[model samples]
Target chain A: MMLQFNVLAASILSQYTDFEEIDWNKMWEATKETLFMTVGSVIIVFILGLAIGLILYETSNQHSLAANITYRVVSILVNVFRSIPFIILIVLLIPVTKQLLDTMVGPKAALPALIVSSAPFYARLVETGFREIDKGVVEAVESMGANKWQVIFKVLIPESLPSIAAGITTTTISLVGFTAMAAVIGAGGLGNMAYLDGFQRNKPAVTLAATVIILIIVFLIQGIGDRIVRRVDKR
Target chain B: MIELANIKKIYETKRGKLTAVDGVDLSINDGDIFGIIGYSGAGKSTLVRMFNGLEKPTSGDVTINGSKISALKGKALRSKRQKIGMIFQHFNLLWSRTVLENVLLPLEIAGVPKKEQKSKAQELIRLVGLEGREEAYPSQLSGGQKQRVGIARALANEPTLLLCDEATSALDPQTTDEVLDLLVDINQKLKLTIIIITHEMHVIRKICNRVAVMESGKVVEEGHVIDIFKKPQQEITKRFIRQDTNPDSEDTDVALSQLLTEYPEGKLIHLTFHGEQTNQPVLSRIIRQYPVELNVIQGSIQQAKEDSIGSLYVQITGDNDVIEQAIQQIKNMDVEVEVINDVTV
Candidate 1:
C-alpha cells in the first residue's frame, strides 16, 4: 500500500514541474515588499485614524448647531471612504495616488490606497471604543478643571487605548491582505509573486509557500495585538 | 459663602423645553456641610453641577468666594473650577491610573510643580486611609476604596469647595458609613465646604448641618438639618424623613402587632425630640416621676450635625390615671407625644 501511495504521489507530482523548487531570492524580495507596505501603511493609518476618531467623537452628541454640522460632515466623509470595496478602492485611488506619488507601480505605490481604505474603517472602531468609556469619567475630569487638551490626553486617549490597540491589530492584518491585493495591479509583493511567478509559471509550490507566510504574519500580528490589548485593558 | 440667586436651568429637548432647575435661591456658609435632598430628576444634580459651572444657569447667578460662577466663561470658568472639586456616586475614577496617579491628575491639570504633585498625591492617598495601596489601580479596589481614591483625586488641588453628588449612594450601608465618616473627617480637618446631593435622608441626618428639600425642580423646604428632622414642613419632605424613620414599613407593622399582643392594656405613645432636647433624660425622668412600668417598645435617635433628633414609641402599663399623668409631663418637658394607638389614650 505504501508503494501504491508513492506511485500515486509521483503521478500527481509529474504533472507540475519545479513544484518544489521555489526561488528563495525572489521570495525574500516579495516578503520585503509586503512587509514594507504593511508597516508603512500601519504607521500612517494609526495617526490619521486617531485624529479622525477624535474629531468624530468630540463633535457628536452635542447641543451646538455647529458641532452637529461638523459631526455630520465628518461622519459622511468617513462613511464614504469606508464603504467602498477595497479592490475597487485601489483602482479608484489610481489617479490620486499618481498625482500624489508621481508613480503607481511598486509596493510604495500601494501605501496611499491601503491607508485611505483602512484608516476610516479603523476610525469607526476607535469611535466605538471612545463610546464605551463612561460619560461620567469625562465629567469627573472636567470637574477637576482639566482643559480640553488635558481631558483628551489624560482620560480620553488613555482610557480607550485597549480598543485602539485592538483596532490597530485588525487594521494591520487587513493591511497585509491589502498589500497582497495591490499586487494584482503590478505592485510587487508575495501576491504578485504568487500570481506572476507561481500560477502563470505553473509552480504551485510558490503559491502555497506565499499563503503560509501571509498566515504566519497574520498570526504574529494577532498574538502581539492581544498582548498589547490585555496589557492596557485594566477594566 | 456660596450664594445662588434665582438659578434656573432649562434644557431644550426635541419634544420641548424641559425645566431642570427652576428659580432656586440658596446661601451656604463656609465650614457648613450642606445637603440638597431630593428624589431622582428633582433638579438636585443640575443645581449642584452649577456650583462648579459644569452646567450654566439659564437666568441666574452662582456666586462662590466673591466670583460669579455662572457668569464666568471658558478659561475663567475652567480656572475657577480648579478651586472646586467634585466626587460622584460611581466613584468615576480613571481605571487606567493607579491611586497615586489618579490623585495626581487634578494637580497636573492645575500646573502644580511636578515635584510637589507626587508628594501632594501621596499625602492625599494617606489622608483617605489608602497609604499602602497608592500603587494599586481602581479596578483592584473595592467600591469604598475607589471612592476614597475619588475623594483623594477631588481634593488633589486643595479645593476649598467639594461637591459630593451622591458620593456614598453606590456603597453598602457599612461602606456608606465609612465614606461618610471620611467626608466628615475631611470637612473638619480641611474645613472644606462640602455640598452633598442625595435622596437618602440618612445621609443628611448623619452629616449635614443644613439641608434643602427639593420637589419638582424647586426647594420646598430649607433649614437646619435638626429642624427638618424634627418638623418636616411639606408632604414630600415628610416622606423623606419617614423613609429614615421607618425604613421598612412592614417591619413597623410587625413590631406594632408584637407590641400590642405583648401588652394589650399597655399605652403606646410616640415621642418626638428636637435638637438639644434629645440629650435630656426625659424618658428616665418620666419613669422616675411616675409609678408606672414604661417599657420602651421602639426608639431611634438620629444625630443631626451638632445635635440629635430622636423618636421613641413607648408602652406604659400601670394605673390609667398615672400613665396619663406621665404623658402630660413628657409634653410639658417640650417632648411632643402622640398616641400611636387609642388603646390606652
Candidate 2:
C-alpha cells in the first residue's frame, strides 16, 4: 500500500511543474520553522503577558496593592506597544531581536520580535479577562485571608482561565499570521515558502498548500482553545 | 467580639471626596447575629467591610477579640482575615472551580493540609446542605445554591466572625428566608459572630439579635431588634419598620390623607403595641370603658423573633372629653398612642 501511494504521488507531481519543482525537504524545514517560531513566541508571550496583566490588575485595584504610579506606567507602556503596527514593530524591534537571539534572519531570530509585538496585545486581553472577573470574588478571597500571591494564583488566574484561554487562542492565531510576515525578514517558514516560491515564482499551487497548512494549524488551535474554554468555564 | 470605634470611609472620586461611612462606633458581641440595616448608599456595606479590613477606615480603629484589626498589616492582617469570613451579595464563587474546590479555597489560602482541606470542605458542603453537589460548579447552581456554596466556602476556615454584605438582597423572598435560616442555624451551632448588612428590614427582623439603623453614612439608631421594631427613633428606622409590617401598603401619610377624607369628624389615633402588650385586648377594653364609637381603619400585627409588635389606626367618634379619656385609658395599657388628627364636628 505504501509503494502504491508513493507511485501515485510521483505521477501526480510529474503532471505539475510547480509540484515537481517543490523541494519536499525544504518544505518540511519551513513547516518546522513556522511551528518553532509560533510555539516559542506563544510560550514567551503567555508568561510575560500574564505577569504584566496581573500587575496591571493589582496596581489598578483600589483596595488590593493599589500602586497608582505603577498602574499608570504599565498602562502607558501597554498602550504605546499596542499602538504600533505589527510590521513596523518588527523593524523597530530589530536591534533588540538581534541582541536577544544573536541573529536576525531565521525562525529563531523572528521569535523575540514576534513576542515583543504580541505580548502587549495579549497582556491587554489578559487584563480584560482579569477585569471581567467580579471584584466581589477578589474581595471574598481577600476576606478569606488570601495574601496577594494567593489571590492572583488561586482566585484571579483560575477564575479567569476560560478568558485567558480564549486570549491564548487569539494570540496564537495572530502569531501564525505574524510568522508569515517574519518570512519577509528571511525567517524561513510557510510564509516564506508561499511568498518566495509560490507568489514570486508564480507557483499558485505551492501558495495554496501553504495556505491550507496554516488554516489547518489555526483550526486546530481554535478547536483546542474552545474545548479548554468550555471545560474551564463554569459560569 | 468585634468593635468598630469611630470608623469612617471617605472615597475620593473625580468629582470630590464622598464619605461612605461617617464616624460610627459599634460593638458586636460574640455569638450574636448583628445586622446593619440601611438603604442603598447608607454605608452599611462600608461598615461591614471595615470589620474584616476589606475597607480601610479613613479614621478610627477596628478591634476584634482584643487585636486591633485596623492596625494589623501584611501577614498579621491576612491572618486576622482568615478568622473573619465574608460573603457577598453576589456569591463570588470561582467559576472555574467546583463547589468543593470553591470551599477549599479558604483552606488553600490558609495553607491547610491537602487531606484536611478535603475533609473540611466536604463537611462544610454538607453543613450548607450541599452534600451531593461537591463536584457541581457555581454557575450550574441556583442563586440559593450558589449562596449555599458561598456560605460553605466562608465557613471552610472555621471563621469565628462572618460578615455578610447584603447577603440576601440579591435573592428572592423565599431564598432570602432560606439563607437567613441557614445563617441563624450556623450562628447557633458554631457560636459564630455574624454581622449582616442589608437594606431589607425583614432580613434583620428574621435573624438579627441586634440592629443598627444607618442613614447617610451614620448609625442613626442602635439597639435590640425587638426594641427597634417597637419604638423606632429615626424617620428612616420608622420607614424600615413600616416596610416590615406593611410591605405592599402605601406610605403612612398617604393612608392618613385617605382616612381623613373618609372620616371627617373623628379623632384619628395611631396605636402601637409591643411584646406582651400585643396580646392584650386594649382596643376592646377602651371601647367598653368609654361611650365612644371606634372605627378600625388599617392595622398590622407582626411577630419579630420572640417579640410581637402590632400597630393600628382607629378613628374614634365621641365628644372631645370622652375621646381624651379613652386615649388615656389605652395609653395606660402600655400601648403607644399617637393622636394623628383631631377634627371636631
Candidate 3:
C-alpha cells in the first residue's frame, strides 16, 4: 500500500509541475524575442520621445506665433497617440508597419506599433519632467551667458534626468506588455508561445512559466531603472 | 561707466499692458557699490536686469561700458551677459551640481579651457571662503553657503560688474552680515562695479557708496549714501531711513509720544552727523554751549561705505531762546538738526 501511494503522489506532482509540453528551447527563444521587442522599441522610443518632449517644452509658453503653432501641433499629436489602447494601436498601425517593415509576424515587425504607442506615452512624461524644473534655475543659466542649447543640455536635461529615467523605464515595461499583445496577431514571443502551446492546448504549466519569466523581466527593469535614478538624483 | 537713458520695461499680460519700469536715467561708475532700494512692486528688480541685458527695455538705451546692452541680440547679448553677473535672493543654484561644478558652469559657458576652469573655480571657491565643500551639493549647504557658491559662480567669468538682487534677503541676520562682508571684499578686491537691489535700508547704510530710492517705477531720490542719511528729501526716503535708524519704530514712536507728553517744556530734536562731525562729540559740544539739560532718547551710529553717519533723537529742556541758539550752533558745526516740535507748533 505504501509503495502504491508513493507512486500515485509522484504522478500527481509531475502532472501539474512538470512542464514537458513546454519546449525549453522554444521558451528561451520566445524570451529573447520579447527582450528584442522591448530593447529595440525602447531605444527608438527614448530618442523620439525626448525630441517631441523638448519641442513641446520650448514652445509651450513662448508668445511667438510659430512657437504657439508648434506647441499646439506637437501636444495634440502626443495626446492622441498616448490616449490609444496598445492592442488597438497595434491593429491601427498594421498597414503602416507592413509598409515600413514588410512583415507582421515576428519581434521586428511589432517594432513600429510598439514605438508609436509608447514614444508619445513617454513624451508626455518627459514634458512634465521638464516643466517641473525651476524657472529661476534656467534664468540663472542664461545669466551665466549659456546660450539656449547649453541651457537645455547642461542644465535642463541634467536636472530632469531622474524623472526622464523613470519615464523610459515605465514606457519600456508597457512595451513588454504590448509585445505580448502583438503576439496575438502573429508577432512571435512568449505570449504567442503560451497562447498556442498552453492556452489552446490546455497546458497550465507552460502558461505559468511564461507569466513568471515576464514578471522577472519587469522586476529587473524596474530595479535597474531605480538604481540609475538614485545615482543621478542628488536633489 | 554704465549709463541708462530713460529705460523702460512694459509687460503685456493676459489682463492688460503694465508698466514695470516707467522711465529711468542714471549713470553707474566703475568700482562704486551702488544700491537701489524700493518695496517689492517698485521695479527695483526690473531696473537691475537692464544691466545684463537680461531684460531689454521696451524703450530707451542701456549703455554699459560703451556697449548698447539693450540693442544686443543672440550671441552678442549672451557674451555681453558673461561680463555682468547677477546673484539672487534664492541663490538660484543648480542643485544637481556640486559647489565646484556649479562654479565651473559659467567658465564652461564662456568656453574656458577645462584645466583653467577647474583651477579658476577652485580659486573662486576659496575666495568665497567655501574652500573645502567643493563636492557638496546646494541642498547640503546653509543659506549663506549656497550664496557663497552663487558669488563664486558669478565671479567665475571674471565679470566686470556684479548685480545683487536681494542677495542677502533670504539669510538670517548673522549670515546676511557675512554675505555682505564677502560682497564688499569682492567689490574692493576685484575693483568690480557692484549694484545692490534691496528693500532694506540697513543694507544700503552698511555697504553702499551711493543709492537710488525708487517709488512707483521712478527714482524718487538718488544721492550719496551718507548724504541721503543726513538729508532724506522724499517721504519714502525718510521711511526707509527710519527703518534702519529706528528698527523697532512702533515702540520708538510710542515712547517718543510719551516723552513729548511728559516733557511738554522740552524740545524733541532730530540730529544727523556725517563724516568729521560723527567722529567728534557734536551733541556734547552743543549741550555744553547751551544752558540746557539733554536726554538722549534713541541713537545709532552706522558706517555707510567709507564714511560714518550718526542719527540721534534727543529731548532738550531749557528756555526756548537757548534751544534756538543751540540749534544754530549745531547747524554751524555741519550737523543737520531738525526741530521735532512740528506736532506742537
**DockQ leader:** 1
| lDDT: worst 10-residue window of model 3 chain A | A12-21
User: What's the residue-level lDDT of A229 in candidate 3?
Assistant: 94
DockQ of predictions, in order shown:
0.84, 0.75, 0.70
Please identify model 3 stretches exceeding 4 Å from their true place.
A1-16, B260-266, B279-293, B317-322, B341-345
Q: What local lDDT does model 3 show for residue A221?
A: 95
lDDT of 3 by residue, B1-345 (tens): 999999888999989988889899889999999999999999999999888888889999999889899999999999989999999999989988999999999999999998899999999999999999999999999999999999999999999999999999999989999999999999999999999999999899889999999999998899889889999999899889887887876666777888888888889988988888878887788777789888888898877777888888888889989988888888898888887753321
RMSD, model 1, all Cα superposed?
3.5
lDDT of 1 by residue, B113-201 (tens): 99999999999999999999988899999999999999999998888999999999999999999999999999999999999999999
Residue-level lDDT of model 3, residues A1-235, one tens digit each, is: 9999999988866755768777899899999999999999999999999999999999998989999999999989888988899889888888998899788778898999889899998888999999999988898899988988999898889999999999998988888888899886788888887788778887867888898999999999999999999999998
In TM-score terms, candidate 3 sits at: 0.94
Query: lDDT of model 3 at residue A14?
Result: 73
Docking class of 3: medium
Model 2, residue B172: C-alpha shift (Å): 1.5
Structural similarity to truth (TM-score) of each candidate: 0.91, 0.93, 0.94
lDDT of 2 by residue, A1-235 (tens): 9999999998766544456667778888888999999999999999999999988887886543448888988999989988888788888888987888789898988887788888999999999999988888888888998888888889789889988999999999999999999887899999999999888987767877788889999999999999999988878
